[model samples]
Target chain A: MMGISEYFESARIAYQAIIANKTRAFLTSLGIVIGIFFVIMMGWFLDGLDNAFDKTINAIGTDMLYVDKWSWGGSDDWRSVQKRKPISYQQALEASKKMTTAELVAPHASKWGGKITYQGNTLGSVSIVGVTAPFVNTPIGNLKEGRFFSETEDVHSVEVVILGYKVANAFFPDRSPLGEIMRINGRKFLVIGVVNKRGTIITDFIDNQVFIPIQTFMGMFGTARRGVQIAVKAGSQELLDEVREETRVIARQVRNLQPGEEDDFTINESQMFRDEISTLRLYVWGIGIGLTGLSFFVGIIGIMNIMFVSVTERTKEIGIRKALGAKNRSIMWQFLVESSTLCLFGAFIGFLLCATVIFAITSAFPDVDFLTPYVPLHLLFIASIVSIIVGIFAGLIPAYRASRLDPVEALRYE
Target chain B: MNNDIIINIEDVAKTYQMGAETVHALRSVSLQIRKNEYIAIMGPSGSGKSTMMNIVGCLDTPTKGTYLFENENVATMNDNELADIRNRKIGFVFQTFNLLARASTLKNVELPLVYAGVKKDERQQRAFAALESVGLQDRTHHKPNELSGGQRQRVAIARALVTKPSIILADEPTGNLDSKTGVEIMRLFGELWKNGNTVILVTHEEDIARHAHRIVRIRDGMIESDTINPSPAEV
Candidate 1:
């Protein structure tokens, strides 16, 4: 028997049958469409979340690594991290001078709950960070409207403040905020700059905080000798590891740590961001693949159901073909082609719908990565192959049943 | 004539289980039919004429004894083997004009070749030739439902004749048609037989039975008589 020719003929016949019942065929494809729709949508949502996090990381500056006595955010130890001593200015200065890889090193001092008042309008209980001019070059102090303060202001320990964009907007919406006088914790400070409208985890980055020169913050709010952390910049991402190691050695010396004692600080930068995203990606693929699988199952079910109906409805046809000379394999292939065609069509429609929805949502709120169109070629390719496999399996029992019918009995069938 | 018997039945019996009891559909029936010989089996309901026809068509296996087609014993044949002989050797035309209602006349005629795994061009050409023989060439593309009863029966005859099987087992092939349409269908069968094809017509009507050169009467699962019609029914 010419298997190829037979299969093609049978497939053509089967396709004709499906076309004859367009409403049923289209409805069946809908199941597959809905299934793929959700799966692709999940991909877009995941991408949006990833983009938001990436923006946050970029906002913190690529050049600067946070050198702190403990990791930022919550503690892994919880108890031990709470008991740790703060990084001192002398240790920071020593680490800065020793690390040849560092392009800029600025000691950071923390002053909590600093109030900012501009005339009658005021925002209270905001985090007030005090750091030197290094932040000016780093992305952390990048501005939209006004420039960062000069190194001279930082050295003089001048009473000056840089308002966050939202903070300035709240008080001086129509006017330039630069050179305006604001009081930080009841102390007069000349507004030197306003930051860009940066996004945040919860609060708007610009609206939530105030920035003052590190030296002036220590002199006025707390102790001049105190340092909370150091904002250290490695010249490039490649130099970060080397700069971190050298700073560790210098910090140990400055802290007078005995040999073999665990180093007191970690250099937190790109690696942390990578690690976080790596973990996040695992969760994304896990959930995404899982949910996608469920929809694919629905596609399979639709194919199976349709094929079963097709077998019965075309009983006489199958019988007639059998009488004519159809091999069992040819009959099987006919239904297989039919089912796979339906499902693959569904996948196409589903992805199209996903694209339309993505575009619509992104147009409404332009932050969405609408054009990303994350159709993993391999996954989709595999899904299509699997759909075909499922198509064959779904067609198998029915095709067999069809081919097994007695020609004479079927011809005699009512 | 090849004079070689293409089909032979030796004391073949078939019993069907109907709920509580087994009904002997055919009892010790033995017959031999040569290729290209027209014959008719005639009997009323419950006479087992249909059962005998089924055994001859390879639609059912016998309960006892041997059935042979072209020296190949059919009683011991597997489903696939029986199917092979059925598809290649025996064509069937039903009393009710059992054409595939949804398929075109060409497709209905091509049914056997499709099973035979014939190529598309060959299947279509063969079906067209068969339709042409039954004078259905113009209506080849029409569905069974779209055709009149006479036309539908002609399509079914075309389907039965398309495979060019050894014997055409037609069971009351014209029972569904009006008298004039039925006579027309029988005339077509006479033409098929004249063209050197073996035609086996099963009908209880004596006039229809008379159309065949030989008639075998079956009653109570037994062959009551076999005789040649002196003056057969005129087409």
Candidate 2:
């Protein structure tokens, strides 16, 4: 093995050679720059997606299960699910009362495509969700301002509402919406609270929904025909499966299904959202890796071709060094250093470009939840390591060829 | 091999396979040299003088017979071993000067030491001393392209001498210079020889070969004459 000083000398020689041919070095490393840029951007995007997905799934409450007419995650046939009878508000209430392992149960009945108006401003295609006072204990039900409606207000059907974060922001940009009276379907309701910003790309509609008491909703729009979904939160994460099983039994009892009959309603959990996100992430990664691999392959070819040219151009120098007592390993190290330095330069440039783009995007849309403001530090580390590996792989053949040159013939080369 | 003999060659031959035919570059040659002897090997083109130089410098091994440098068999040495021997024991001066065009005169001279894993401070000091010996001390930072042909050859000489090798091997060292510049280089070789450094000159020019104390002539891959010059030509 050569000493560290010898390696440094080889690296010094390599640096001089690259500087002597600046244009060729830059052009040769262009492929590496673009490849690394694509790789870093893809990594940043996927990490943002994962982080946002985790936050949104947590907002949906991982320990909670939903008993609804429709199955989530596309697990059941749509036609069959639609043909099943809907869970009534009374049945939901009964099931909630019977669920022993649940921490709290919030029965929800939603009316979509409803309009909410404040002064001259109006938001179209908003969802109006009706739930009891216990909904405040759920994850998405956490308030950003003011307080949730009391059980007294819900029982008395006092027409109090909680606005979603975006709805509040749109309606009262200059002032708080806590005491403002808003009209939902032309009926007046005082805003008592504002839900926190808890929406991701998968569940962005949560931001456009307004919450009201269940009794008020049933009074305005008759209760017999509308279906209700029950949100059941487990006492602890460890009791989720037990709560789910108990909820299923309560639901079956509420619906009065025969022993042999399969329960009509579906019990959906946040795990369904996680599973879907993972599958989507797999596809994204598949395409991202495929594209990144292709670019790197092209980059490797570019560097290898240029290294071969460099070796040929410096044949006489190789001979001279060999004659000066340089071993084959020394020559190999010289070219390897040159190639890796080129790749490292390219990676720096690529990382800068990626950072600039990410900075521009995140600054432009500061409210965006799924785009991070800066690239992660670990991704930079990964890119540098990957670039060096690529450089070594690309420079291997050319370096070996340079090391094996016949000193006499190489010196004879013009 | 005698203790005083720095190089010993016995029935050494080299051949090249040219397609289906084998070309005999050297046919059964033998020679010996003491540690401080100054000699020149002279021949026409393809007369095996170049082959002898290659074998003596450890750049190429004999295909037959044996060659011993400092009592070590050169014929059976591996490439790395040959490289090590060349690094420590043989200094080569080429017809073209062969200085790295991009490197300064100092760096070009420091190349051998760099490969030998010498520390930077000592390498620079030694390389500077070598440049001073060749009267290129002031041009240490000048590149080969920036220097004259004679100056470039001096830099190459400085590089050759940096390692303080067992022998200085010059193959047509003045082949690329003008007559005056060529004479100046031969004078430098004479001074080195007078200072007790072993010098071997490989040249087709009689004027250059006459500078040495002894001359050996070859023809058709075999030595024709080996004679001492009673009084060497004045530099």
Q: List per-prediction Cα lDDT, in the order shown.
A: 0.76, 0.89
Q: What is the C-alpha lDDT profile of model 2 across B127-164, one tens digit per residue?
A: 99999999999999998999999999999998999999
Measured with C-alpha atoms, the lDDT of residue B30 in candidate 1 is 82
- Candidate 1 on A1-414: residue-level lDDT in tens? 445655666567767776788888878777677767766676666666676567667766666687786775543576776566777777777776776767887777666676788786678777788878777766667776666778898899888888776677778889898888888888888887888766654224434677888888877767544447777778787787787777777778887889998766666664466566667778877887777677667766777788888878777666655554455555666777787777776777777787788767766765333234344444456556655665666566766676667765665554
Q: Where does model 1 exceed 4 Å of error?
A: A1-34, A50-64, A73-75, A101-228, A231-244, A259-264, A273-360, A367-414, B1-5, B8-11, B17-22, B63-68, B71-76, B119-122, B219-234
For each candidate, report what fraction of the true interface contacts it reproduces. Answer: 0.41, 0.77
For residue B79, model 1's alpha carbon misses the true position, in angstroms, by: 3.4
* Residue B68 lDDT in candidate 1: 79
User: TM-scores for chain A, candidates in order?
Assistant: 0.80, 0.96
RMSD of each: 5.3, 1.7
Per-residue lDDT of model 2, residues A46-111, tens digit only? 898888888877888889888999888787888888998888998988887787778999999999
DockQ of each: 0.31, 0.79
CAPRI band of model 2? medium
